[model samples]
Target: MSNVQDAIVNAKDKLPNVTPTPPGFHPEASVHELKSRLLWGEPGLSIIDVRDHDAYNQCRIRGAMNMPMDRLPGGAEFSLQKDRDIYVYGANSGDTSQAVQMLREAGFRRVAELKGGLEAWREIDGPLEGVDSMDDPGPDAYNVFARLQAFNEEKAKEKRMK
Candidate 1:
């Protein structure tokens, strides 16, 4: 039929199947919701860390950009489109809400605050960056590859005890 219709059919065939975001979602996103969107391969979204630089550097959601609350106006204007899907977080709920307000006032239409910050992200095992952000630190402080060996040792000790 129409070229636009044909293109839509073709594109739908090529794209991976993904669950769409539900309607009626609030202006705040839970860590689980953001994680689900990321897992579903959603694109054209930005995750912003509105905490201080040191806190961001110490640990933050993987791929999150550090745009401390004070700098949101200029930074968002320079780097983000007004209609971009932006999820921002800060030190706490109040800070996140404040950052969301700043972004909205600066003309960002699709901004949402991430509730519960990094601690909530940690609960869902969301990816993070930093030395302390490892999902599995194993039992050794100095050896990165020691987990398997430790597991084997534990198994052997169990066998001996049995």
Candidate 2:
């Protein structure tokens, strides 16, 4: 093989596994898996919290949209395409499983239960909303524009360093 071809092969081999993992349904997924997927920034996926309103308002996986169990089916049908990759959770594992089942039965094929829900996510230091009660706020914690700008700058710096 030419030098360029060999280098391309080597680089592809070293690429992060998560980047090559196509979005799809799994019966369950750990917080770390979901975190990697989010950091990889593939679009076409969503995190859903099926917990009640108050609980969802208190804490949840950042970027999660709430659709309490009672309203889940209708809500999902209204907003989501059947093939979109969806990660769902509730108050606990059991609830999470139930929510996943509900979504699957509703004709949504790519639905995975988020294992361990919010607590597991917290254990992994995953980004969260409604975390004001738990820790001191960072300067751009709730500032979307500021956070986006900082993220963009950091990514640019990393690219330059690379």
Candidate 3:
């Protein structure tokens, strides 16, 4: 089967029996809500930040444990109970989706991604730490622009060659 078809089958098999959350369920909560939920003790909720260690150390929702996508196989050792809510986030949805897939494959029942990621959090003036200065552009925005530029440049180069 084609990779895309395989991916569709795999994704369908991985989704929990429970109804998935509608898109944009919590339109306002930032990364701060994620932190609060973890800190204030949602008995079964656990937060996983899928960003790399460097970015994680620079700043992340307090108490969020790093579970970078590349390292998620190790998460099986954590023995996460299938019953709990597993909240995953990255600099944005792209990374979050990958992590959610991993968690689902591992049989997590309730998984949710933080909407808009850290950028949305900051936009709404959400709480943050280890961010001594706000001079740095967000990684999510930068990555999107960089990818677009690369694609455009490649297309331009192809046109010139043609």
Candidate 4:
């Protein structure tokens, strides 16, 4: 029994239970607070929506820019100055965190994630434009919508040919 206990202690020591930082950007404020900050806070903060283009166009924070995660690293076309605060958010938690990390790696210093993503924004009654608030679709839904739209256009062309 002592030998087994010794082995267990050794194994435990070898396996350091390091808690990873909670995934996603940690917002300094709730959605309402964010809204107020954006609208009333000091100048220089930029809101960045890290979802796809369609999602961004469908409905997003009024002035937020669409900076998709997959296209990051080499695809970013903006000049984000090091001194400005950058707020990032997506449809959900995990993706937003991943986006924040990518931005940090790409050299963004002042970065934060909207707590709970857009869903939380809706919860806080944050205003949005374009699509309805009820139409908060996930990433996969956006992909499906894009494919369907393409297929519909192709079918229209075929009909015109006949």
Candidate 5:
């Protein structure tokens, strides 16, 4: 083999084998996995919400930074380390994967799509902010909505006691 060919082979070997994905991790990380990591106090990672500004501002996972999908490259480049662990989610898995693909193409080495997006996070009772308290009852109160309703009920009970 030519010297250049040998060098190329060496470089390829150094790159991670992304096809099979690393053991104990997936290209799309589950909400449970992320929750465990947060509980374990894992460091060297960042979560990105790729939804639009309005949605992100209205409600988002606590500690997640906004980096809208359309603005990913520019939004992330200045603030985020290319090699650090990045867990990203958008409106759904497809949007999340698209963002992840873009980040990888832009030379980010450790971007992972967050599976099930914000809904799953909320299901797991993950921390969140920017959501307004619901004033009226709505259909299908469960998970996050259930928690909010519970809070409101507790507050009402307290007021009655007072």
Candidate 6:
């Protein structure tokens, strides 16, 4: 058999369960967990910001949609599916929890409160978009390897500090 075929066979034997497993969907998720999902290019989940219009326009998790608290349930009902995995946040933990409760009451089964909101995401340097996040994406924006390396460094720094 070819060397490539042999390598594949060996690899399969060594790691029989190897597969793409995105971060777990839970009632609450950490910023790192969400970041890991984005880095792996998983798009099965949604991030919703429950903050008001101005707050959302200022900054938010890159792909997050703004669904302000007052109208959040109605907006989400109109736009999102009941079983969709959703990571929600707001101006604070209280708001985040409240949004999660609202979505659950609205019959959405898979909803999670993203603990620490935008501040936690920014602490780990997650990609963001909005007028307040207008700074250049830097020279390495498209360099996946460099971004991964930076992520690793941040993780290690976090570990060392703790």
Q: Best TM-score goes to which candidate?
A: 6
Query: What is the Å distance of residue 109 in model 5 from its true position?
Result: 0.6
What lDDT tens digits, residue by residue, belong to model 6 across residues 1-162? 346755764564345223433345557778876786676567788999999999999999999999999997999999999988899999999999999999999999878899788999999788889999964678986797876765555444534544
Looking at model 3, the pairs that clash are: none
lDDT of 1 by residue, 42-132 (tens): 5778999999999998899988999998897799999999988899999998999988999999888878888888998897667788656
Query: Lowest-lDDT window of 10 residues in candidate 2?
Result: 17-26
Extract clashing residue pairs from model 4: 24-97
Model 4's TM-score against the true structure: 0.59
TM of each candidate vs. truth: 0.68, 0.69, 0.54, 0.59, 0.65, 0.76
Best-first order by lDDT: 6, 2, 1, 5, 4, 3
Error of 3 at 158 (Å): 47
lDDT score of residue 129 within candidate 3: 57
Worst 10 residues of 5 by lDDT: 17-26
Better of 3 and 5 by TM-score: 5
Candidates in order have lDDT scores of 0.72, 0.74, 0.58, 0.61, 0.70, 0.80
**Candidate 5: which stretches are off by over 4 Å?**
1-25, 133-162
lDDT of 4 by residue, 1-162 (tens): 246655764564345325211111233334643554443323667788888999998888766878888777454436577545778888788888888788778877667777766777766555576564454434543474553443344333423534
Decide which is better by lDDT, 1 or 6: 6
Q: How many clashes (backbone N, Cα, C below 3 Å) per candidate?
A: 0, 0, 0, 1, 0, 0
Model 1 Cα displacement at 67 (Å)? 0.3
TM-score for candidate 2, please give it. Answer: 0.69
- Provide the global lDDT of candidate 3 against the true structure: 0.58
The Cα RMSD in angstroms, rounded to one decimal, for candidate 2 relative to the true structure is: 8.8
Give the lDDT of residue 95 in candidate 2: 88
Give the per-residue lDDT of model 5 (tens digit) for 8-105.
64564345544211123346677765655554445778999999989998888878999998797888888998887889999888889899999989
Error of 1 at 104 (Å): 0.3
Question: Which residue ranges in model 3 land beyond 4 Å of their true spot?
Answer: 1-41, 76-79, 131-162
The predictions' CA RMSDs to the true structure, in order, are 12.2, 8.8, 14.3, 18.8, 14.8, 8.6
Candidate 4 Cα errors over 4 Å, as ranges: 1-29, 75-77, 133-162
Candidate 2 lDDT over residue span 1-162, tens digit each: 346755765575356544243222345766655765665556779999999989888887788999999997999999999988899989988888888898989999778888788888888677888745365447765675664554444334433534
